[model samples]
Target: MPHTPGSYTTSDLSRKSGDIIAEALRHPVTITQRNKPRLVLLNIEDYDRLMRQSDARSAMTLETMPDELFGEFETAVGAYADSDEAGR
Candidate 1:
């Protein structure tokens, strides 16, 4: 198999933990087991940033959504209701 940068096997993790962790502090690293990607190692800052980005994307209130998006959502709901009534 081709070697991948920032990827290490389980055995390499055991033997070179310090080096791997140092690299992870600079950028994310992938840990592999049986040649399959298993885990990611990253610095706390990167992890926190990723979590914040995920929360921002997933947790949105109608009050926070822009007017255009709210209008589109309203139209979609209205269409769904019309379809349901037609089916009934």
Candidate 2:
């Protein structure tokens, strides 16, 4: 379930569960029990997108990337410095 920006009591949900579900499909619905938020309902698409974004953010390797992957950048910089010195 996705969590919306506001709180909805369990009783409120019991009374309007269908509407709550529809709203959840569009965004997220926070479910509260005992005045405390307990769950969230999110649309599948939103959930998938969030998961993918989180995975992308957590995935990393550029800093630890093998030198071969960025050797061209160093080579290009070296060439530029050499050319600048020759021009001077």
Candidate 3:
């Protein structure tokens, strides 16, 4: 496979952990094994940001959602239902 930026093999990770972690602090790094991608190393800020984004996408009660987001959700659901009915 073609070499990807920020990608390191498992052996490279074991041998060059400090260097790899430094690089990960600047951006995400992929850890590969057997030429397949296995894991990602990222800074805590990036990880937390990803988790927050995931939380935003997860199921929530209408009462818990902000008014703007609820409006957008309502609009999206209506558009999706309209499209689905058109397809049928």
| Most TM-score-accurate candidate | 1
Give the 10-residue window scoring lowest on summed lDDT in candidate 1.
Answer: 51-60
Query: TM-scores of all models?
Result: 0.61, 0.52, 0.60
Measured with C-alpha atoms, the lDDT of residue 9 in candidate 3 is 94
Off by over 4 Å in 3: 55-88
Count of backbone clashes, every candidate in sequence:
0, 6, 0
Off by over 4 Å in 2: 1-6, 55-88
Query: For residues 1-88, could you state the per-residue lDDT of candidate 2 as single tens digits?
Result: 4434655778878888888888898888888887677888889999988988784434436687568856876788899999999999
Q: For residues 1-88, could you state the per-residue lDDT of candidate 3 as single tens digits?
A: 5558899999998998999999999999999999999999999999999988785556779999989999998999999999999999
**Model 3 CA RMSD to the hidden true structure, in angstroms:** 6.8
| Candidate 1 structure lDDT | 0.93
Model 2 RMSD vs true structure: 6.2
> What ranking of all candidate models by TM-score puts the best one first?
1, 3, 2
Between candidates 1 and 3, the one scoring higher on TM-score is: 1
Q: What is the lDDT of residue 28 in candidate 1?
A: 97
Model 1: per-residue Cα lDDT over 55-82, one tens digit each: 4455679999989989999999999999
Q: Write down the lDDT that model 3 would get.
A: 0.93
- Where does model 1 exceed 4 Å of error? 56-88
Task: RMSD for all candidates, in order, please.
Answer: 7.2, 6.2, 6.8
